[model samples]
Target chain A: MICEEMQERISELMDAELDDNESIPVHRHLSECQTCRSFFTSCQKMREAVQSIPYEDKRADYYETKKEWWRNYVRVPLPAAAVFILLFITGLIGTSMYLLQSDDPYVSGEHRIIYISEYPEIEIHLLTDRE
Target chain B: MDPSIIQKLRNGNEEARTEFYKQYRQQIYVYCYQLLGNRSDAEDTAQETFIKIFNGINSLQTAAAFRSWVYKIARNESFQLIRKKRPVALSHKLEYLEKDSVENLIESEDNARIVRNAIDTLKPEFREVILLREYHHLSYKEIADVMKTTTSAVKTKIFRARKSLLKKLSPYFGGI
Candidate 1:
């Protein structure tokens, strides 16, 4: 095997991302293993090379312009939200007014509520007719 | 991040928000620049990332998660731009070109440039996980959170990224 598991552990250990307890096995393995030792060395070199690329902060003014986009100039979602709330409130009022004033049988409650007992059983009425 | 800063952020304090921005701007810019391989795309992506993070600040649950959260936003934003502008990103690759040997140029500034080119050739998934670990100094667990994957997955991706970089660089200078 390539001491692969320990090599992975060594990567974390090199970065000090592992606590001492978790690092114990890695240390023990590195002490006894050469493959992982070389892996660790290469990882360090790689880190150095990658970190050497200095950060470039280009167009600070342009970046400033891009900032606070949500707070100031959200042209679409804000208007969409306002439209949503307005539609919701309008729908609520329309439904309420329809319930109160319209002549729709369901919404206006103008239809009479007939209890089941108010209707004579069709079977009984049919028997009476036959008799 | 300090808990007090998080609290200030929650309270929508402008100074705290600026503090948060200052803390991350360099890291975010560098990460975006390296990933997108261009200043314009990098700047646009970084700005969109900050906008997303600040706009979604309320959803962050803890102070400790802030670093990974910022990275997650940056990673997503960078990849989104890459997906939209694949040709632009693809043309930017300068990996493994015939150049001065890094071993000879070890003490020179060009070594960093060579290493950077090497990293650029990596496939984005491998490139990202390795950058998060090596360049960003994020822990395996933190990277897992940012990548939305298990730590084992992160370890595997990083290991593969290193091998991939080595394969590219070895052609020129016998590998790191």
Candidate 2:
């Protein structure tokens, strides 16, 4: 194969994506061609250099930055927050209205439980009416 | 990833998620840095990527490749940010970052500087394939999954990226 065709196989060989049988031809081509051999070497060197770019791990920085990002960007959206607030307000108003409407709250002399507007009956013989 | 950690993450355990953040933060940040070519943007994108990862942990299946899943979320988040910020302001940011990068290249050796320059000259798509294949050492299948492209496309991109780099470095290694 010409150098152009072998270059493709050389890439596969470099990546180890080729089987032994497939790589043999590319290897033979490299052995026979100086230009192709140099090309392969250059590719390998470039790959190594790119990978060798050091990755510094500042754990504290990463932690702080991640927390900051979450605080700044990952919070609830404005629309969602608005929806949540609306739901909360609706619930508050509902409970307030129910409590306000609690006129006959079954004020019993025996039971010590508080039921607001529920069980709307003045227990029997309780309060004595004082009328 | 251990099955227990995956389980914990799926259960929304913050510590387990933090563990994953510690493990992949550098890699994800480097990827975003190289792709976006800005430290500030890369940091923001990487952190948001983790948030998306934790938020979508349930999408990870037991049989799936965990790293691929992580990269897919990261890639999507990065692209979303890019789309959101696709204004003239972005080009200005990139130009400034390029200047910063150029200053650092002077401190590196000639060969390293040449390689960096060659890599930077590549289109972002090709550069990503090279970084994924060489730096990250991801399999073509995994890269395809992360990129949402076919393995054939990944292979083609890697080849073209190598070719581009070789042409750019021909001054030093001129046999090609």
Candidate 3:
């Protein structure tokens, strides 16, 4: 009869779950027991076959579907935020321009006078005949 | 936009509902296919799964867990299908080795086919543990979560399932 310890450790050995210290006993048991060795080989094969099932880049489609679903169901409208931002920027610019043009009495009123423009005097000649 | 649409849907927004279908239909279809192992049953289950997800989202306690929740629904639907089908019993009579066909050789095509068939014939409980462990690469804890069992239980189940599968495959591979 196969030892329970050996049977339990056989699959673990194939899976490499047994530590190096633990593997010695499994290796010795497999060397001595033909049945257990065969079991180990088949276990390895089964693991390989299952692993070969092709994770298949399933992520591509999964990501696409997630994106599509989010776009349709969970997405929020950002147009309002964009509009608010635009209005805030416009108001800031308008206020800045108004401040720049407004006369600041504290910094102004120094008289380094340049010549002001003089309008031409219209000397109208009366009708000579009436003189 | 969809909250408006969702509000409309609550008030009978056919358009918003249509949008929901357009969005999730493919994912549901693929997930169903993965679970059911065939296209036709998957298509039906996918439709049903979506309907449940839609009608029941309000009752959900956590939105972040929705994928697992939806998977749970699909898994249940697939199990129901399996129950209804109640597949035929396997034929295990060893009729092949009787023939003088030199068919028992190690590494023969017949051996591989037999091993494959054996794997296919494994009880669903064992099969699922193997699949979740090897194919899905789930850790013991994660599998326990999916299977609704404790981590130690999952580990024991996986160990046992692998042992059983190896036993079934050993004869074909020429037991040393």
Best by DockQ: 2
lDDT string for model 2 (A35-125, tens) is 7898889888778778766544454274755443443434453467789999999999998777766544443333244344766564433
The DockQ-derived docking category for candidate 1 is acceptable
Q: Candidate 3: deviation at residue B94, Å?
A: 19
Candidate 2 residue lDDT tens string, B18-42: 6777688788887777666667777
Going through the candidates in order, the fraction of native interface contacts each one reproduces equals 0.40, 0.39, 0.24
Question: TM-score for all predictions?
Answer: 0.69, 0.71, 0.47
User: Which residue pairs clash within candidate 1?
Assistant: none
Q: For each of the candidates, give the backbone clash count.
A: 0, 0, 1
lDDT of 1 by residue, B1-176 (tens): 89898887766666777778778887898888877777878877877887787667778988899899889889889889889988755654533233443444455656667777667557878878877877788988899998899988887788778778766666443543
DockQ of each: 0.23, 0.25, 0.10
Best model per lDDT? 2
Candidate number 2, chain A TM-score: 0.45
Better of 2 and 3 by TM-score: 2
Q: Relative to the true structure, how large is the alpha-carbon lDDT of every model?
A: 0.73, 0.75, 0.59
* Rank list by DockQ: 2, 1, 3
- Give the chain B TM-score achieved by candidate 2: 0.84
DockQ of 3: 0.10
Docking class of 3: incorrect
TM-score of chain A of each: 0.46, 0.45, 0.43
Better structure of 2 and 3 per lDDT = 2
